[model samples]
Target: MFAVGFGANHFIPLLQVYREGMASSEASLTAMVGVYAAGLIPALLYFGRLSDQIGRKSVLMPGLWVALVGTLILALGAFSQEWPLYLGRIIIGVSVGMGMACGAAWIKQLSTDDPVAGPRRATVAVSAGFGLGPLISGVIAEFAPAPDFLPYVIHAAVTLCALWWLRAAPETQEGRGVGKRKIVPPVVFTAAYLLAIVAWAPWTFGAPTTAFVTNPSQIGIDSAFPTLVQGLLAFLTMFSSLFIQPVVAKLLANGPRWLALAALGLTTTAAGLGVAVAAALTGSVWLMLITAPVLGTAYGIFMVAGLAETERFADDGELGALVGIFYSLTYLGFFVPFLISMLVTGAENVFGMDPTQAYVGVLAVGVVVCLASIWPVSKAAGYGGRS
Candidate 1:
């Protein structure tokens, strides 16, 4: 529920910004979508550890409230000037950053006995909520009379409802004999290999694809398609986690971490290359439809692998802090490209290429980065046997 609210609020207003007044050429559209992620990175960096010290519920409730306020700001932003969009995005980013770290940790704690089930459920909840948000928002925006106001109004209501539901949910972390600890932020490593996978796989396969689907020349594609595609990709990617996770958990669950890591790296690299090929050759909407699932599955594998690796490295006491660090890096992978796009408005200038093609170029870079990272990641994970 928190995930849904966060995801919905993140993208809907950005879409509206494009719809209302922003020129497609300005890359404001991409920046608007990207800024939420920008906010997420910092929150994950600084505040993610807070959940560890306090409690999951303590962090989560306040985060949701912040999200609600952000949504309200977004709603009001639609009426006021353009700057509200940035403000709302920043606020929503903070909410999501805080929510994602705490929420995932909370779910993990609830299902603690079963490691596979716990993480699987946590991943699904986050992914599904993210997917659903755009689907609902897109439908409402496309069909509803007052597109902008209604979608956000509905989002705010849903957020409140989630907040109410959470009031009854149990806290995963109990107040401990543990004394008040200093708020120590986790150190962030680039996780070059992991980051490569993220840049190539999730960014290329997941993020830019949304923009591709929105390209005008792409047959049967539009802004709505991007939103819908993003939703679908999120759902499928997370859903794969539900099934494959258990199998992986059993095989290398704790047995051979390097093998599991390598497999993920290879699969993600392949998927990125596949999408790049599909984009280059067919340029068909049907190809994109097919690529979506392939890429999404790859994304799921990468996410699970990354999280598992984080768990493998973390001490039990510092799990929450590590999770926060991991997520902050992940969000960084998610947003930096959109900021780059905003800087390079060349998408508007290209004659033969559509906005989607520009997106493809961005994705291709990610793919290349991923491919290059495999050897380094293998080294980092101590997969000398495989290498």
Candidate 2:
């Protein structure tokens, strides 16, 4: 899970390199980030079912090889090639989607001795990968020789070990082929689940992503080491996510219901967006940095809450599929940057707002959207309570 996740987000900080090295357009750059979903959603939808049919080892081992292949593609792409980067990102997404389902499932199986710890550890492992990958790669990209290529080399090296490690891990699932059970779980379409899909899921990645990638350039940050700065923002957000999970666990220990956790997480994400608004308006890079952990806390809360909800709602047969759904929705947030870029350009042409002013409006709208979600989300929680 950690290695796959490292491959997943390691490409993010390199966007700056692509932009500067390849002279990529903003639209194309943002597409690279959003394009991850293209490969991820399909894998997410079925890898769960695939893992359920085949053993976890069968799905996971191949996924690691795919991850290394993706990283190598990225390294090659660094030689001023644009299409390779995009292709690499798509491939990385597929591998990540596989790991998200099967790796997590395998971890859960291994931790059968301690039921509650499995999900927590899985979350931590991937999230830590997400944070550190960018941090290390960003630094290396900033100062090391072959900035673009070296980071991928490091990641590929680490991922190679994962292949061996997972080889020794026991297989959890049998190749049951197709049972009478359905692939798409019923709970996913329920009103309670729909609330997460609509309201909570998008912002799961949206908030933290907006913090690091989207706003940094728009807010007039002219750092000497752009990659490092981006990496720090990502690092801060993810590490904060890791630290806050324990707090969330304690808060939920009393069983205050997932609704409160969802509401608070979304609302806090809104507040972070609100801060982002201030940061952009004032052109304060430091203020922008402050928003990273705030948004990340909300991200952490949502992750814990989302996984807990999956456990609550899914049967053993449907767990992987449900996990896939949860993550698929969150990956949608990757498109937030692309959407923001498009909207800002459109606003400049149609609404007659400058890019900076237009971006501020978009962020402000995000704040409102998050705040508004509280009611519907709570209603969903109410449904859960009633049932």
Candidate 3:
């Protein structure tokens, strides 16, 4: 599970480096980031059901092997042309899709009847892995011998260890019948459940995901230190997830869950405004640092709470299917960056605003979405209290 996330993220700090190395356009670099979803979404949709039918180990082992291959492909790209990089991202995405679906379920099965413990453990592992991957990669790339080549080499070694460790883990799905499991969106959910999902939804499309990779230059950061900056941002995000989630979970347990989400949404909106202001004020990078706390806390709470709410509403028969759908929807945020980039470019041309303003302008749309979610949040709170 950890390897799944680590492999997916280890390349982010290298995006700018790759761009300069390959003389690639921003559009192509953006495509490489967005292309991850291209493979991940479909693999998640299929493997979620497939894992239920076969077994966790059956899905996980193969996924690990595929991810190893993807890591190698990415390493090869440091010496080759651009295509291998994008292709590597896609293959890594596919492996993540499978690992998330099967690995979470497997963890749940091993949790000895503690529902909360299972998903919580899996979420933390993934979040930590995702956070640490870029941090490790960036440090190595910045100080180590083979900037592009060595990071992947280290990850390749980690991947092998994870693959070997899986051999002794027990399989959960023994003798389960294979049946047709289609991803049908839930037509009905209690108001609280709906709010929990909606409140967290914007985290996917919001700034935290994009700023580190795309907007670093707008904050007056130099090209030579992008790896350090990216690594710092990744750590902020990961640390926030690790530290804030339990606090938010405790708050939700004590009070209205919907209110917690509402607060998170407002924090995110404030962070977006901060980004705009930082850019306007001569790109004050320190002020711009607000993106991490707001986005990270919101993402952490939303994900953990949203999964809990979804599980509350889901039927036992379709647990795997529901989780798959939930993940797919969450990941849909990956597309938001590409779509917003297009709009930002257009707005820049039409209104003559700078990249920072354009970035914030798009974020305004997300703010509206966050505010509009308050109604559902209210409903979710009411429902959670009663049931």
On lDDT, the candidate that comes out on top is 2
Question: If ranked by lDDT, best first, what sequence of candidates would result?
Answer: 2, 3, 1
Measured over all alpha carbons after superposition, the RMSD of each candidate to the real structure, in angstroms, is 4.7, 2.0, 2.9
Residue-by-residue lDDT tens digits, candidate 3, 215-257: 5533445545767667766666655676766675565456554
RMSD of 2: 2.0
Q: What is the C-alpha lDDT of each candidate?
A: 0.56, 0.81, 0.69
What would the per-residue lDDT of candidate 1 be over residues 109-189, giving only the tens digit for each residue?
787577655545655566556545656665665556665566677777777888888989898676742344433423223
User: For every model in order, what is the number of clashing pairs?
Assistant: 1, 1, 1
TM-score of 1: 0.79
What stretches of model 3 exceed 4 Å from their correct place?
185-202, 205-207, 217-220, 252-254, 257-281, 381-387
Candidates' TM-scores? 0.79, 0.95, 0.89
lDDT score, residue 150, model 3?
92
Clashing pairs in 2: 53-175
- The 10 consecutive residues of candidate 2 with the worst lDDT sum are 378-387
Candidate 2: regions farther than 4 A off: 175-181, 196-198, 382-387
Give the residue spans of candidate 1 off by over 4 A.
1-17, 20-26, 177-258, 262-266, 280-282, 336-362, 382-387
Please give the lDDT score for candidate 1.
Answer: 0.56
